[model samples]
Structure formats: C-alpha cells, structure tokens
Target chain A: MKEIWTITRRELQAYFDSLMAYILLILFLGFSGFFTWIYGSDIFFVKQANLQVFFSIAYWTLFFFIPALTMRLLSEENRSGTIELLLTKPISEWQVIVAKFLAALLLIVAALALTTPYYITVSSLGNIDNGAVFSGYLALILVSGMYIAIGLFTSSITNNQIVAYLLALSIGIFFQIIFQMLSSNLTGIAGGVTDYLSINSHFESMTRGVIDSRDLIYFLSVIVLGLVFSESMLMKKRSV
Target chain B: MDIVIENMTKTYGRQKAVDNISLQVKTGEILGFLGPNGAGKTTTMKAITSFLIPDSGKIFIGNISVNDNPQEAKKNIGYLPENNPLYEDMPVIDYLQFCARIEGIAKDKINDKVREVIQTCGISREKHKKISELSKGYKQRVGLAQALIHDPEVLILDEPTTGLDPNQIIEIRELIKKIGKEKTVILSSHILAEVEATCDRIVIIKKGKIVADGTVEELRSQAQGNETLKVTIEDGGLDEIFKALQLLNTVELVDFVDKSTQTFQVKSKPGQSSRRDVFNLCVEKGWTLTQLTFIETRLEDIFYELTLDN
Candidate 1:
C-alpha cells in the first residue's frame, strides 16, 4: 500500500503540475454547461427542474474528456522511457496499474464535483427528486470509470498517446453508442447480446433514480475486465 | 550484496538480445560492462535489475532469486537505466523522495537520505528545479541521486556518463569511485578510457556474448598474446641495429622505423622480457639506446578487434 501511494501521489501531482489538468477541467465544465443550458435543452425550455439535460450532455462530454485525461497515463511514460524506471523499482506491476487508476479516478471525481453547482441551481429553480439527481451523478461516475479503464488499457498497448486516444475512443464507441444503436434496431438474440454489451443501457437504468444490482454488476465487471487486460498488457512487456 | 547470473538468455523474434552468459560480482566490486552499440548491454542490465525476465537463466542478488521474489531482490539494487529517464515535470527533490519511498526507506530518514544523495551527486542546487529545467549534467546527477537515496547494496548504471562534458564526467566518475568503495557497481560505458580508469575489472561483450573479461593488463595480454616494443636508438646505424636485433632469440621482428629508430615486435615466452636481450645486444654493439617503450594493446584495440567484423 505504501508503494502504491508513492506512485499515486507522484502521478496525481504530475497531473496538477501540468496545464493538461486545467485545460481538461475547463473543457469538461464548459461543454457540460453549454450543452445543458444554451444549445441542447435549457431548463426554461423543458419547463421542469430536472437535471436530465445536464446528465445527457455529460455522457457525451465524458466520452471525449475521459479518454483525453487517461490517454497519457501509461503511454507517455512508455514514450519517455520512464515506465522502465518506474517498473524497475521494488514495486510490482499490479501496484503501478492500481496507483495510476486511482489517480485518474480521483481527477475525474474532482471534475465531477465541480459540476455540483448545476445541481444546486436545479434545486433552486423548482422541486427536483434528489434521489434521481444523486443517481444521475452516480451513473456518470460509473460510466466515466468504465471509459477511463478502457483508455488505460489502450494506453498500455501503445507508446503513442494519440494512438492510445484514438484506439480507446474507437473501442469505447462500440460500447457507448454502436451497441446501443444495434441493440435497439436488431431483434432476437443478437439484439439481446448487444444490449447486454452496451454500457448505455446499464447507465440508463441507473439514471432512473434507483440502484439495481445487475447494472452495478455490469459496470463493475467492465471495470474489472479493463483493469485486468491493462495489467496483462503491462506484464507482457516484461517478457518481450 | 553480491550478484550472480547463470545461463541468462533473452531473445526477440529469433534475435538474441542477451545470449547465454554467466557472470558474478562480489560485494564492493566495480564491473565495467563494455560492448558495441547493439551488444545487448542494456538488455542484460535490465534482466539483472528485474525489469525484464530472462528466457532461460537465473539472477540472484544476495542469494535471493531475481526471477522469483523480485521485490526482495529489487530492494537491494538501485538502477540508473540508459538515457536516465526521469519525470521531467517533477522537481529533483520530489523525484528523489518518490524513489526513496518506493525503495521503502523509512519515512523519518527520507529527508536526511535525500540530502545525503543530493550532496553526494552534487545536485543540491538543482534539487528545487524541475528536471526539464536542468542541464544535462545536472539531470544525470539527479538520476544518480535518485538511485542512491535508498542506499541500496548494489548499483547498476547504464552509460552513466554518456553525455557529460569532460569535467562532469570526471566528477561522476569520482563519485562512482567513492560509492564503489562500499557498494557493488555494474556500469556499462562506451568510453573505454573511462572504464579502464575506473573499473577494477571489465567484461567486454560482442554479439550478446562476453568476448573478454579481466583486469586491464590481463585483457591486454590476452588480446595479442605478445608485446610490441618501439626502440629509439641514437648514435647507432639502422643497418647495424637491424642486423644485431636478429641475433637476439627473443626479438621476433625488427623493422626500420626512421633514420635511427626501429620497432622490434617480439613475442616473449611466459615470464620473460625481450628487452633484456635487446639491452645486452645494444651493449655488445656499442650502440646508444635513447628510448624503449612497449606498445600496449589498449581496450579500444581489443574492442574493435572483437566487435568490428560482426
């Protein structure tokens, strides 16, 4: 745990020490605010105090934002050759992976926390279901976690950050939108499998203001699978 | 701690980066690993440091297997890998502290330990600056400082002085020498003179195999298996010296070099000197001997002879 914290602390500091973090935070909040209030569906236009517009906009904003934030986690280290320096320490590969995951997750949480004013504004406007608002944020965190893991795995596979970003985005799109589209349009087992594979269906369920075990299991399973694949990719580098 | 490796080999798609090789470095020994550009020096160092796994070999640091319990073995080693990759965004002090923490140094002693290494590596002034803001020499010092903060029993440095100016190289070499008095150091360098001056023993590799291993003089003798001597004679005719040089049984070949000097390349039998016979011959011929110097086969010559063809 000490070793993992050592890595995590340094990585977290690195994120704040650079301009990337500030840029990401601004872009995430700016896009979320713009899409939710001005362009997509304003509270006045919807005639309700619900934050569904913000949550809906966040889904797309997070897709690009999470990948940008995570694409450099391992890929930059590999490109700069610091991965070798880091891995050769007494710490294990699993520890490095876990530390990086926690660091990126913390940054994402901070970004999400900054969006709290939107919820406060919605509450001030009219009566709003607090449970649904809480669930909406919870669903955002789960989906963001899933995407971050996928980004980390793709980052581990390649040393180029741009390549990692594109690869992760491509794979994430399959689960984010393609599967959702296919599942709704197709029928029978194919549609059922696509629906099960798509993360949006699970996220949609969570956004309905109730927590379900199946949706939680689905997100958790994706997180575990992504982390496991990332760990295996890093371990394979040791042999080759 | 002592490091022992046996039958270590690592291959990449049929190309062996580190072929079967065995070596041992006792405690407090400085082993200079010398090789050509692609001779697998980095690969071997990585395998020993637990950064890479060997295909068919075993590495033990203080009797703990590097292939098995790497965490325990890694605690004994501090490696400054080639290119000295560091977090450019981090301050030198923070980077060292990070390394000390990862190396499991006690929290209470982290500050003092970082101080000691910063002083030892002569990077105290640069400690507060970001790594990317420092010059190459100070960057290298930060690299060394990071490796030393834990005070590990073994230190592995790959091309530690590759890019430094003359003064910085000497400084780092002096630092390594001071540290080598207490720790086992395995450093690879293309600078033969630096290695010859600093390392107590050298292991020269070519094509992923060790071609030469010994002290400077021992390896020199092993390279040519004979000695060449340059004789500068004054007040003596070249023809007289040439004719008289053949009379000595120890003198193998005498070639006229210039007006009065001639180079006598000789192969002495074990534990014998051809100069003794040459001195006597000069005395007998009433010739004046101005200078006599042996042409020692340098590490550069041996490195080229071993690595040039392949």
Candidate 2:
C-alpha cells in the first residue's frame, strides 16, 4: 500500500511537473464553460433550475480529456524505459496499475472541484434540484473513472501515448454510444441487454437524482475489468 | 548475499534470448560480464533483477528464489539497466528519494540515504538540477546513485561506463571497485580493457552461452595465438638476419619496426620460444642482436578467439 501511494504521488507530481496538467485543466474548463454558459442552447436558453447543461457539456469534455490525461501514465514510462526501473523495485504489477488509476482519478477530482463556481452560480439564480446535482457529480466521477481505466489499459498496451489515447477513445466509443444506439434500434432481449450494458443508461439513471446499486455495480465492473486488463498487459511485458 | 542461477533461459518467439546458462557470483567479488551485442547479457541481468521472468530455471538471491519470491529477491538487488533510464523531468534529489522509497527505506531515513548515495556517486554538485538538464556523465552518475540509494547487497550494473569519457570512466571504475569491496557486483561491458582493469573475475558470454570465465591472466594464457617479438639487430646487414628469421615456420609475419636501429618485429607460433631460435640463428649468421622483446597475447585476441568461432 505504501508503495502504491508513493507511485501515485510521483505520477501526480509528474502531471504538474510538465505543462500537461495546466493545459488539460484550462482546455477542459474552457470547453465545458463555453458550451454550458456561452454557447447555443445553454443554461439560460433552457431556463432549467439544475445544471443539466453543465453536466452534459462536462461529460463530453471529460470523455476526450480523460484519455489525454491518462495517456502518459504508463505509456511514457514504457517509452522511457522507466517501467523496467519501476518493475524492478519491490512492487507488484497490480500495485503499479492501481496507483496509476488512482492518480488519474485524483486529477479528475481536481478538475471537477474547479467547476464549483458553476454550481454556486446556478444555485444562486433559482431553485435547483440539490439531490439531482449531487448524483450528477457522483455519476461524472464514476464515468471519469471508467474512461481513465480504459485509457490506462490502452497505455499499457503500447509505448506510444497517441496510440494509447486513440485506442482508449475507440474502445470508449462502444460503451458511450454504440450500446445506446443498439439499445434503441434492437428489440426484446437484445435491446434490453444493450440498454443494461450501455454506460449512458447507468449515467442517465444517476443524473435523474437517483442512485441504484445496479448502476454502481455496472460502473465498478468496468473499472475492475479495465484495471485487470492493464495489469495483465504489464505481466506480459515482464515476461517478454 | 551472493547470487545463484541455474539453467536460466528466456526466449522471444522462436529465438532464445537467454539460453540455458548458469553462473554464480560470490559475495564481495567484482564479476565482469563481457559479451558482444545480442549475446543475452542484458537478458540474464534482467532475470536476476526480476525485471523479466525466465522461461525455465530459477535465480536465487541470498537463498531467496526469484521465481517464487520475486519482490523479496528484488529488494536485495540494485540494478542499473543498460540505458539507465531516468525521469528527466524530476530533479536529482526527488528521483533519488523516489528510488529510496521504492527500495523500502524508512521514510525518515530517505533524506540521509539520498545524501549518502549522492556523495558516493559524486553527484552532489548537480543534485539540484533536473536529470535531463545534467550532462550525460552526470546523468549516469544519477543512475548509479539510485542503484546505491538502498545499499542492496547485490549490484547489477549493465554498461556502467558507457557514454563516459576516459576520465569519467576511470572515476566510475574506481567507484565500482570501491563499492565491490563490500558488495557483490556484476557489471557487463563490451570493453575488455575496462573489465580487465576493474573486475576480479571475467566471464565472456556469446550467443546466450558462457564461452570463457576466469581471471585476465588465466584467459590470456588459454588464448591460442601467435607471439609477437620485437627484434632489433645492428643496422648493418639487417636483410641477411631478416631473411634467416623468416625461414623458420614459427615466424609467421615479420615487419620493419625502425630503419635507424634495424628493428624488425617477428611473430612466432604459440608456446614456441622465438627468442631462443632467433638468438641461435643470429649467432650462426654472425649478426649482432641489439634487442629482443616479447609482446604478450592480449585479451582482445582471447575474446575474439572465444566468441567469433563459427
């Protein structure tokens, strides 16, 4: 556990040590704010009491941002041959994977925290659905974790960060929309299966001011599967 | 603790990167691993450090089996890999501290340990700079420092002196010798002279197999090559002596050394005393021999003979 945290700390420090963290934060906030407040069909246009515009815009922004953030977590280490130095230490592959995952999660949390003024401004304007707002943020956290996991897994697959990012985005597209697309077009058992598996279905349920154990399990399962896949890739590298 | 390996082998696809090979390094001995490119030197080192899992056999570090207990085995080893990859964005001190942390040193002792390692590696002046900003030699020193931060019993340094200038190489060599005084050191290099200068015992591997293992003198004595003799006769009537010298089958090649002194280099078959035969011939020919010297067969000849065999 100590080793894991130490790795996490270093990984997090690396993000801030370079211009990547600042650039990512600025881009995320800029795009999300522009779409939610300054662009067409924003909160003012909808005249809604909650932050559905912000959540919707932020979710899409995070979809692209998380991969860029997580791309370097393992890929850079592999490219620089630091992974050899890291694995030779007294730490397991799983510990390294978990540490990388936690570091990306922490960065997402920081980005979310920076958007607090949006919540404050919306609440001050009119009556808002506090329950729905909390659930929305929580759902964002879960979705961020899912994308980060996929990014990490892709990063472990190759030493190229761009390839990792693209791979993560490609794999994530299936969960983000393909499943939803199939769910709407298919019927009966196939439709039900796709709807149950689609990340949007679970994300949608949480954004409506309700938390379900089933939705939590679905998100947690994807997280576990992605992390486990990343760990397996590392093990293969160690063997190779 | 000493390291032990038995029949360790690692294969990539159909090619065997590390063939079934076994060797041991006794405690407090500096073992130089000499090999050409793609000779499985790095693969074997990686196996010992637990960076790569061998396909078969086992590595034991101080009686701890690396295959069964890799983390524990890794704790006892400080490996400086071939390229010495480091976090370029990280400053020297932070990198050392990170190494110390992963090495399992106490949190409070990390500072002291990093300081001690910096002193040992002679990187104190550049400790404040980022790794990428430092010179190549300084970066190499940082690599050594990280390996020594935990003071592990075993140190596996691959190409430790590579990319360093002559002065820096000597400095690093002396440092390795000092470190090897108390720790078992296994260093790999293509430079035979450096290995001869620093290592107590030298092992040459080729194509994933141990071809030679012994001291410098032992390996040199085993080398089957021609002996070179620098012979200098009086400047007068040197052609007659040169002619008679080349008559003997033992003298393979003869070349002029100096026109003023009539110095001519002569080569003789292995285990044959060219001086005795040449002296008798000089006396018979009435040629006054001013100088007769023997050049020892070098490690280069031995390394080539052992590794370049078809």
Each candidate's DockQ: 0.89, 0.79
How would you encode candidate 2's per-residue C-alpha lDDT over B1-310 as one tens digit per residue?
Answer: 8899899989998999888999999999999998889999999999999989999998999989999999998898988998999999999999999999988899999999999999988998999999999998999999999888889999999999989999999999999999999999999999989999999999999989999999898887777456789998873576776787899767777888886788999988776767788888878767788898887878888888888968
Q: CA shift at B62, candidate 2, in angstroms?
A: 1.0
Tens digits of per-residue lDDT for model 1, A68-127 = 888999999989999999888888888998899888888888998999899899899999
lDDT of 2: 0.91
**Prediction RMSDs, each to the true structure:** 1.8, 2.6
lDDT of each: 0.88, 0.91
- After superposition, the stretches of candidate 2 with alpha carbons farther than 4 Å from their true spots are B224-228, B235-286
User: Please, what are the lDDT tens digits per residue for candidate 1 over residues B6-114?
Assistant: 9999998899988899999989999999999989999999998899999999999999999999988988888999999999999888989999899898999999999
CAPRI tier of model 1: high
| Position B160, candidate 1: lDDT | 96
Looking at candidate 2, what is the lDDT of residue B292? 89
- Model 2 earns a TM-score of 0.93
